[model samples]
Target: MSRWILVGVLWLAGASAAFAIDQEIAFSDPSMNTRYLSLIREIRCPKCLNESIADSDAPVAADLRREVRRLMGDGKSDDDIKDFLSARYGDFVLYRPRVSETTWALWAGPFVFLVIGGIVFWRIVRSRLGQPLDDEESAA
Candidate 1:
């Protein structure tokens, strides 16, 4: 039993090495490195769904990080890189997708629901206000 436990402890210690990002990208300009970091945080990992590329350990996130660095080296503006990725991967790749006709519903849906809820609440309260208190409760 002690032998198996030692093996398990060794396995757990080595497992974290797999999660470390092994890339050695070097940016000549500090600003470019900053931009690269920002872009990775803003872009969603295609495989991870909810994780930003910067936070995801998925292979696709690493590939996307490489592509972002390549684009920066090619002198592409941040918006241009984003546009390229958006065109290739669809708007879902962007953390803050452009508000267009298709996305208007997504942007406006919350406010619309809030307004409907307010109306429903107001109607319920108004109706209750019009009723008298219960006779037993009023006497008490």
Candidate 2:
């Protein structure tokens, strides 16, 4: 019976330690909480693209989330935090990269391609639907 009691105490202590280690940030100012949450949501987990760091359970994501909180506590603004993370992790860490000369293609290339594709598709459909002119029109 003494051995069982000892084991039970050990188990409870271990459980509490585990819980303490996983404790999340508790913001002193509620406004900071909103900013912190927004920053996390904009950050992508390198390991998990489908989930934001805020929603990811991966260890790396958790560490990144904690790092963001630390930066916020240190009075870093949102852009400063983003720039720090981007410099360390690259633009891939950002869920949405800003459009600029450096990233112009990344931002606008897709839409350009879509427009080109739509033009080609429309031409194909129009030709199939009897919109193609005859050789006489071409000669004129």
Candidate 3:
């Protein structure tokens, strides 16, 4: 029974080791590899809400990774590859999408809201100052 237990432990360890293989794609040019890493991290996984391609394990992420590798091997520029993916997946695929007629609102919405909020805040403060405080409120 002790021998069987030892065999079971060994088998479990070996099975885990077999499944621990790291899958990495290497390029002959170090620059190409660096660009690949950067692109993966910069590209969002379409199937995931907020995960990058580098961090996502979705089937679409895997397909995108393979496509990126193939595009790089074909000597496509980083921008060219990004444009191709954008064309297929829309600007959502990019972490920082370029500003365009369609995306102008996305880039400017926060600042516009901030200015409106500031104006509203100023008006509220001005109106409050114009009112005389009640005796109880002033005492507090």
Q: Which is the leading candidate under TM-score?
A: 1
Q: Which stretches of candidate 3 lie over 4 Å from their true place?
A: 1-22, 109-140
The CA lDDT of each predicted structure is: 0.80, 0.78, 0.81
Give candidate 2 misplaced runs (Cα > 4 Å): 1-25, 100-102, 109-140
Off by over 4 Å in 1: 1-35, 72-77, 134-140
lDDT of 3 by residue, 36-106 (tens): 77788899999996988877889998889889889999989989999999999999999988999988999
- Rank the candidate models, highest lDDT first: 3, 1, 2
Tens-place lDDT digits, model 1, residues 50-102? 99987798998888888888888899998999998999899999998889999
lDDT by residue for model 2 (1-140), tens:
99999977865554443234346433646467556666788999988888888778899988898888888889999899889899998888988897767898998898999999999999989877866667998899
Enumerate clash totals for all models, in the order shown. Answer: 0, 0, 0
Worst 10 contiguous positions by lDDT, candidate 1: 13-22
Score every model by TM-score: 0.62, 0.59, 0.61
Superposition error at 131 for model 2 (Å): 15
Q: Is 1 or 3 the stronger prediction by TM-score?
A: 1
Q: How close is candidate 2 to the true structure, as a TM-score?
A: 0.59
